[model samples]
Target: MKDPVDILSALADPTRLGAIRLLWDGEEHCVCELMRKLGASQSRMSRHMATLKVAGLVIDRRDAQWVRYRRNPALSPAVAAVVDAALALPVTEKAEEIAA
Candidate 1:
């Protein structure tokens, strides 16, 4: 698992946090899907997913020209708990506005 601080910091950004939320269901999401849902550009979404990967919060694989990502399935119980807690936090009004 990544350092607690790194995991927390990785999730501090709204984009990354939103990615995590989307992956929380344990479904692999392609970069295009993430971009469409998050309303981010390809480069920007890739950058955010890279950050999550570095934090050990997500894993990715190439699918033709696109990359797919999902939550790390091998997370330690403690790490999973932390992620659950973070996901439990309510979305902020600003984030809601962005989604709208």
Candidate 2:
């Protein structure tokens, strides 16, 4: 069985971290918004998202052509705590630039 710590480590990447941070603020976000906020290529963002999904850190729903993602509230208390902590941090300058 895969270690839960290893799953968390997968989400530790800067880019994936940023993506999770962005989703932390709101209920959900479309792929384009994530790509824009992270300034990542579609493929790159997709890969990171896939990692998060595999880690059970994120959940996704499709809206037409867009796939929206959000933190998995159903996660264990420990994981939810980590996600809450990440959301508390101020948005980074890079994230702002991408938001703009």
Best by TM-score: 1
Candidate 2 colliding pairs: none
Off by over 4 Å in 2: 85-100
lDDT per residue (tens digit) for residues 1-100 in model 2: 2357856686557788878877776489998988977788888889889888888888999999889999877777777776677656777775466555
Name the weakest run of 10 consecutive residues (lDDT summed) in model 2: 1-10
Task: Kindly list the per-residue Cα lDDT of model 1 for residues 1-100, writing each as its tens digit.
Answer: 5799989998888888888989999999999999988889999999999999999989999999999999899999898898899889999986665455
- Per-candidate clashes come to 0, 0
Q: What lDDT does the true structure give each of the candidates? A: 0.89, 0.78
Model 2 vs. true fold: TM: 0.77
For all predicted structures, in order, the TM-scores are: 0.95, 0.77
lDDT of 1 at 52: 93
Residue 97 in model 1: lDDT: 55
Local error of candidate 1 at 35, Å?
0.5
List the pairs of residues colliding in candidate 1: none
What's the distance in Å from true for residue 17, model 2? 0.5
